[model samples]
Target: MNETKLHDLIEKMTLEEKAAQMSQVVSSFIHKGSSDEKITGPFAGMEVANEDMTGSGSVLGATGADNLRTIQKAYLERSRLGIPLLFMADVIHGYKTVFPVPLALGCTWDPKAVEESAAIAAKESAAAGLHVTFSPMVDLVRDPRWGRVMESTGEDPYLNGVLARALVRGYQGDDLKNDQSKLAACVKHFAAYGAPEGGRDYNTVDMSRRQLMEYYLPAYEAALDEGAELVMTAFNTVEGIPATSNKWLMRDLLRKEMGFDGVLISDWGAVQEAIPHGVAADNRDAALKAVTAGLDIEMMTPCYVQHLKTLVEENVISEALLDEAVLRILKLKNKLGLFENPYRGADTELEETVMLSETHRKAARETAAKSCVLLKNEGVLPLRKSQNVALIGPFAESTDLMGPWSIFGEEKDVVSVRTGMTEKLDTEPAVEKGCDIEAVLPEQLEAAVEAAKQAEVVVLALGEHSEMSGEAGSRTNIKLPDAQLQLVAEVKKLGKPLVTVLFNGRPLDLHGVVDESNAVLEAWYPGTEAGHAVADLLFGDTNPSGKLTMSFPHNVGQVPVYYNSFNTGRPKDQIDPEDRFASKYLDAPNGPLFPFGFGLSYTTFTYSSLALSSEVMEENGTIRVSVNVQNTGAVAGEETVQMYVRDLVGEVVRPVKELKGFSKIHLEPGETKQVVFEVDEESLKYHHSDLTYTCDAGEFIVSVGPDSRNTEEGRFSYSPAGRSGQE
Candidate 1:
C-alpha cells in the first residue's frame, strides 16, 4: 500500500479502533474460543474487551503456519479496516536449528559466520510464520554478574558494533519486501540496559552523559546505521527516568539526534513498569508519558487499549500523536508486504523441510566448532581414536545444550557429547554420569574415579546448568558448584591426563578447573550440533580458532575487569610491588586470568617485522601499519591479528589500549603472511567532555599482537590543522 492509501485508511478509523491498533496481545488472547472467555493468569489485571482482541494490530509468541493462518483470517474478518496483524517473537539466537549463545558467537570473531547463522535463523523463523524478531541485542556489558551478559556480544564497543551490523544485515537483507525468508530486525534494550548497578538485572543505571555517549550508545548507533526497522526500550531507568517514558532519551536523542524514524516499541510491560519505577502514578499516567515520549506500540499491556482513546478525546494528548504512532506501525506492516499478502511466507510444507534440515545443522556445526576457545593445553588434546577415553559428568548424555531464550528449540533434536565421541572413536569411549549438575553421591564418585583409572585419558564435561545464565539469572559467586569441584578433586587423585570441556553461558573464574586439568576448552553451550562440533575439535578434524570477547576475572571480587579500561593516576603496573597506596590488589593481580582476544591453538604463531608507512598522520591522511605473522609450529592453524591504539596524552584520561581493528588469517606450517591495517584521523576520534566526536593532535602508541596483554609496539604522531604541538 502507498502512503496515500495508508493515510486514507487511518482517517476512516474510529477512536476505539485506533487505540486497539496500538495494543498488542499474546496469541492465546486471539485464538479460537477466546472471545467469550475471561482473561486470567498473568493477564488477569488487564482490562480488555473482545473487540479489542479482534482489532489488535500485532500478536506476540505465536508460531506455526497453520495456527497463524487461522488467527490472521479470523482477525482480518473482524477488523473494521481489515489491517493485517504482525507476528513477532523472541527469536534471539535461532528458531529450531539453534546456534551457540550470543556470547560464544562473539568469541568466534568471525562476522561472516555470525551473519550466516543469523540468516539461517531468519529462514527458519519466517517459515514458521514470524514477521519480526527481537534480536541483535547490542548492549555493551562489562559485568558478568549481570545475567543478560550472555545475550550481548561482548565488552568492546567496536566489536559489539561490528557484530551488530552483521546481525541486522542477516535478519533484514537488502530487500525486505522481496525476500520472504528475512525478518525485520529489532535492536533492543534501547539505551544502556547493560550497566545495571551491582550487576543485577533491571537495577538502577546511573552514569554521566559523557559515559553514556562514549561507551553505551555506539553499538545502538551502529545498528541504526545498518537500517534496523525497529527499536525496543530498555526495562531499566536512564538518569532516574524510565527509558520507556523519558522524552529526552526517546524523542530528543533516539529520534532527533540518532535519526531513527522507525517504530519504537516497549520491552515487555515496560510502559506500566514506570509506576513501579516511581515515575508514573497509574496505568493512565504511564500511557500518557509513554506516548508523549514517542513510543509506538504497547506490548503485553492494556495502557494503550484502555486509556489512549480517552486521553485523545479529552485533549490531554493530541490526536495527531496517536495517528502518527499508528501510521508508523502500519508502515512497517506494509514494508513486510503483509498488506498485500497477510500470510506472507506462511507455509506448513516449508516449515517441515526447513526447520532442522541437514543444511542448517551443517552450518550450526561449523559455527559451533569455530566458537570453542582453547584456554589451556598440555599436549593432551587431539586424542587418537585408539586411545581409551572416559567421558564423565552431567552433560555426557544430557541434551540440554540450547541455552536460555531459545523458546522454540526441542531437546530431542539436540546432539549429545557421548553420541559425538562414540561416532568419532574406533571404539566407543566409556561414558558415566559422574554427578548431577548440583549434587554428587559417594557411589557416583567411586564409579567415575574407577572409569578414570581404567582409561588412558579423561574428558570431564562439567559446568552450570542452562538456567544459570541469561535474563534474571544473576549470581554473586561465579565459581563452579561445590559438588562439581569435589568431583574434580576426587578424580584428580588418579592423576590421569585430564581435558576439561566446559559448557557454560558466561565467562567464569576457572580457579579449580584451570589449575587441575591438562587441557581446558571453553565450549559455551554449543547448540543443535554441539556433540558433532566438540568431536571435530577433540579428534583433530578442525582447529580451535575462537578467542574470548569478554575477560575472565581471577575471582568474583574483580567483577568488572576489561581490557579497555581507563588508566588511573596511580596505575597498578607503574608502581612498585611494595607501594600500598597505588591501585593494586593486595592478594591478587590487577588483571584478568584470560584477557580479551585471548585464545590458544595447537600450533603457535609469532609476530615480527613491524613496519609503519609514516611516523606522523595528518588530517584526512591515512597511515599503513603492517606486521608479519608466521605459523612457527608443526601444524597449520588460523590466527586473529589484533590492532590497538593508545593515546599518550589527552584532554581527559584515556584507556591504556583500545582495540581498533583485527584480521583473521589462515596459514599452513612455516607459512608467513603480512597483514596491513589503515589508520586515519577518524580512527582515533573520541567523545570529548562537550560531546564532540573528534580526534586530538598528539602522540599515539600503535600495538599489534595476538591478545591485549602481550603485543609489539610502535609510536606515531597525529598532526591535524590548528593544533599546536605533538605531546
Candidate 2:
C-alpha cells in the first residue's frame, strides 16, 4: 500500500476504530476463544472488552507461526477495515537461538560479530512471525547497579553508538521491504533511561541538557541514523516530565531535531505511568499528553482506547494528531508488506527448520566465545585436559545460561558448563552444585571442598541467578552472593590452582573471588552455546579477546567509575599523595579495579613506534596517527588497539580522555603491524555550554594503547580555518 492508500484506510476508520489503532494489547486479549474471564496474568486487570481486542492495531508477547497465524486470521475477520495487526516482541539479543546478553556482546569489540548475532536473531524472530523487535537498546549506562544495564552496550558514547548502528543494520538489513527474514529494529529506552537515580529501575533521571547530549543521547541518534524503524520511550523522565508526555523531548528533540520520522511507541505501561509521576491528572490526561507529544502507540495500556475519542470530541486534542498516529502505524504495516500478505514471514514449516537450528547455534557459540573477557589470568587458564579438574558452583550443571529479556529462550536447550568441558577432556571432570544461588547447606560446602581437594585444579563456576539481573533486578550491593563467596573461600584453602568463571549480567565488585582465584573469567550469561564457548576458552582452542565495555569498580562505593571522567580542580594524580584535599579516596583508589578495554589473552602484545603525519591539524583536514603493535608472546592472538583523545582546554570542562577510534587486528608470534587512524576535525567536536557542537582551536593530546588506563600520549594543535602555526 502507498501513502494515498494508507490515508484512505484512515479516512474509512471510525473514531473508536482509529483510537484502537493507536493502542496495543498483550497476545492473550486477541487469541481465539479468549474472553474477559480468561484474561489472567499481567493483563488480567486490563478490563479489555472483546470489541477492543478485535480492533487493536498490534499484539505483543505472541510467538510461533501457527499461533500468530490463528490470531491474525481471527483478528482480520472481525476487523471492519481488515487492516492487519503488527506483531512485536522483546527480541533483545536473540529469539530461540539465544546469544550472549547485550552487555556481553559489547565486550567482543567486534562489530561484525555483533551484527552477525543480530542477523541470526532476526531470522529466527521473523520465522516466528514477529514484525518488530524492541532491541538494540543503546542506552549509555555508567552505573552497573541498574538491572537493565545488561541490555545496554556500555558507558562510552562512541562504542555504544558504533554497536547500535551494527545492531540496526543486522536486524533491519538494507531492504526490510524485500527481505522476509529481516525484522524492523526498534531502538529503545529512548531518552537517557540508563541514568536512573541510584541505578534503580523506573527512578527519576536529572541531568543538564549538555550532559544528556554529550553522553546519553548519542547512541540513540546513532541507531536512528542507521534507519531503525521504531523508537520506544523510556519509563523514566528526561527532566521533571515523564518521557512519554514530554513534548519538548518527544516532538522538539526526537521528531524534529533528531529527524526521527519513525513511529514512536511507549515502553510497557509508560504512558499510564505519567499519572504516578505526578505529571498527569488521570489516564485521560495521560492520553492527551502522550499523543500530542508524538507518541504513536501506547503499549499494554487502554488510556488511548478509552479516552482518545472523547478527548478528540471535546476538542481537548486535535483529530489530526490521531490521524497522524494511526497513519504512522499503518505505514509501518505496509512497509512490512503486511497488506499484500497479512501473514508475512509466518510459516509453521519455516519455524521448525529455522528456530534454534544447528547453523544458528554454531554462530551463537562463536559469538559467545568472542564475548568472554579474561579479567585476570596467572597461567592457570588454558587448562590442561590431562589434569584432574573439579568444576563446582551453582552453574556447573545448571542450564540457565540465557540471561534476562530472553522471553522465548528455553533452558532445556542450553549447554551446561560441565557438558561443554566433558566434550573436550579425555577423562570426565567431577561437577558439583556446591550451593544454591543465595543459600548454601553445610553438607554442600563440605562436598565442594572435598571435590576441590581430590582434584589438582578447581574451576569455580558461580554467579547471580538469571533473575538477579535484567529489568527490575537492581541491587544495592553489586557483589557475588555470600553463599558463593563462602564456597570460594573454602575451596581456596584446598591449595589447588583455582579458576573462577563468572556467569552474570552486570560488572561485579569482585572483592572476594578475585583475591582468592588464580584466574577470573567474566563469562556473562553466554546464551545457548554457553558450555561450548566456555569450554573452548578454558582449553587452548580460543584466546580471550573480549574487553570490558563498562568499568568494574574496586567496590560498590565507587558505583559510577568510568574511564572518561572529568578531572577535578584538585586532581588526585597531580597532587601529593599525603594531601587530604585532593580528589582521592582514603581507603580505595580513585579508579576502577579494571579499566575499560581491559582484557587478557593467552598471548601478549606490545605497542611502540608512535608517529604523527604533522604536529598541527587544520580545519576540514585530517592527521594520520600511526602506531606499531606486535605479538610479544609465543602464540598468535587478536588485539584491540584503542585510540583516545583529550582537549587540553574547552568551552566547558572536558573528560581527561575520550575514546575516538579503535581497530581489532590479528598477528602471529613476533609479528608487527602498523595501525593507522585518521584524526579528522569532526572527532574533536564537543557540546559547549550553549550546546553548540564545535571544536576549539587549541592544544590536544592523542593517546593509543591496549586499554584506557595505560597509554602513550603525544601532543598536537588544532588550528581553525586560517590559522597556520602550532600553539
Model 2, range 341-403, lDDT digits (tens) per residue?
A: 989998889989998899999999999999999998889989998989999999999999999
* lDDT, model 1: 0.90
lDDT values of the candidates? 0.90, 0.90
Query: For candidate 1, lDDT tens digit of each residue in 1-727?
Result: 9999999999999888887778877887777532212121245455553334657788888888888888889888877778999988888889999999999999999999999988999999998888999998999999989888989989999999999999999999998888999999999998899999999988999999989998899999999999999999999899889999999999999999999999899987888889889999998999999999999998878888879889988999999998999999999999999998999988899999999999999999999999999999999988888889999999889898888787788899999999999998987898888899899998998899989999999999998898998888898888888888888888898999999999988889899889999999999989999999998998888999999999999998998999999889999778886889999788888899999999999899999998889999987898899999999988889999999999888877789999899999999999999999988887788888888888889899999999999899998999987784433
| Candidate 2 residue-wise lDDT at 114 | 94
Supply candidate 2's per-residue lDDT for 54: 56
Instruction: For model 2, give the RMSD to the true fold.
Output: 2.1
In TM-score terms, candidate 1 sits at 0.98
Stretches of model 1 off by over 4 angstroms after superposition: 33-52, 725-727
The CA lDDT at 533 in model 2 is 99
Query: Model 2: what TM-score?
Result: 0.98
TM-score of each: 0.98, 0.98
Q: Which ten residues in a row have the lowest lDDT in candidate 2?
A: 34-43
**How many collisions per candidate?**
0, 0
